[model samples]
Target: MMKYLWLGLIFSMAAFRVMAFPAQGGCKLAQQHQITGKVGRAIHNAAQAHVVVRANMLEASLSNAVQAGVLSYQQGHKQWLEVHSVRQQALAYKQGITSHELKQFDHKLDRVTLYLCRH
Candidate 1:
């Protein structure tokens, strides 16, 4: 009975080690996800600021984030396109763009942020 108990303990420890190793990768991925979230939030806040200077600043920050690998090129490109599109629309309409449209773009950014962080 004692020998059987020892064997079981060894097997369990080995299994735990295997599981724990993958969890370290998971923890790293979680950290990446958090950084991406921060960048996404910054983008959202910049859009909400409704100032041209802030928007330009946002573009620069986004470029840096993408270059730093915080965001993928595809994700950054899509966000860039949306930001520019909204800017153009705001310019075309003196009254400015709608919150609903901005929210939609923000939602896309949020989704991409989560996706990138996970994979």
Candidate 2:
């Protein structure tokens, strides 16, 4: 009788452990998914902030270039219109412009547009 009780207790313990494993696995998976979602949100927010800062910088640089006589009124006006269009699109989509394109515009404004302007 003693041996039979011991065997029953051992079997119940084994069954309990088996049942607990799936619950632990589910908890771990849930935690991992929550962490991944938080990380994704952080990345998206950072990207959006970067886009906003770049757009503001580009607008300020264009205004400064015009004020410094590096660009003609007509050229500056045209560039400002382009910037406004990009800003509108970015406001709508949150990622309409890229750093590479912004760099290209900056380079053109610095080198080509300045060269074309009269003193």
Candidate 3:
């Protein structure tokens, strides 16, 4: 009877361990998914920061252009507003945006950059 009770106790302990630990594959997959999510979020944040900083720098350049008479105040203000809009959009989206949309914003900035640098 004692031997049977001891055997049952050991069996129950083993069962408890199996239930607690779970299968390694499932656990590892969950961990991997979590890591992927974190990495994606980090990349997205970095992209937003990069775009916003670029917009700010471009705005500064526009200010300098206006002051130097390379561009008129009217034109500069318009472009400045555009840059602000782009920066705001970059800050707004939580998920990754399409490259086409990014290209459109970059192309607008590039147009201004080229005009400012050339003249």
Candidate 4:
């Protein structure tokens, strides 16, 4: 019984570390909810709220990924550059964020977190 229990535990831990492009299997369902929930809430919040939230998420996620060895510093930095660009554009908009801009922000962020699962 102990042997079987140990094996199950090992497998479960390995399952979460997987970094698959377009995440698949059971992990997808779990990550989709956490990431999507934030996106949903951001949509209803203030205009700057969505942009700020997602920009921070991208920076933090990429930074963590680099530290975890899931992504190299160069890879993480490249994405951070994009995040900076999005934030800058949003701030420059004298007018409140538009629907298309919001979608763009979400779309870019979705790409960044695509492979990440709760770690």
TM-score of each: 0.38, 0.40, 0.55, 0.58
TM-score: model 1 vs. ground truth: 0.38
Q: Is candidate 1 or candidate 4 better by lDDT?
A: 4
lDDT of each: 0.47, 0.45, 0.60, 0.60
- Deviation from native of the Cα of residue 10 in model 1, angstroms: 37
Q: For residues 1-119, what per-residue lDDT tens digits would candidate 3 score against the true structure?
A: 99999999888766644443122222232331222112244237545555665676667767766765557899889878888888787667777546676666666656655555554
Judge candidate 2 against the unseen true structure and give its global Cα lDDT, from 0 to 1: 0.45
Best by TM-score: 4
State the local distance difference test value for candidate 3: 0.60
How well is each residue in 21-92 modelled by candidate 4, as lDDT tens digits?
Answer: 233222353443244223233244355566766576667766756765667788878877888887777666
1-119 per-residue lDDT for model 2 (tens digits):
99999999888766654443222122242331222111132224433344344445445555655665556678767776666665454445444335565444334433432332222
Candidate 2 has its poorest 10 consecutive residues by lDDT at 30-39
After superposing candidate 3, which stretches have Cα over 4 Å from the reference? 1-44, 96-100
- Whole-model lDDT, model 4: 0.60
lDDT of residue 63 for candidate 3: 77
Separate clash counts for every candidate: 0, 0, 0, 0
Q: Where's the lowest-lDDT run of ten residues in candidate 1? A: 32-41
Ranking by lDDT: 4, 3, 1, 2
Clashes of 2: 0
- lDDT tens readout by residue for model 1, 1-119: 99999999888766654443122122243332222212132234333334333334345545654665556788767766665664454344444445675555445444433443343
Candidate 3: TM-score?
A: 0.55
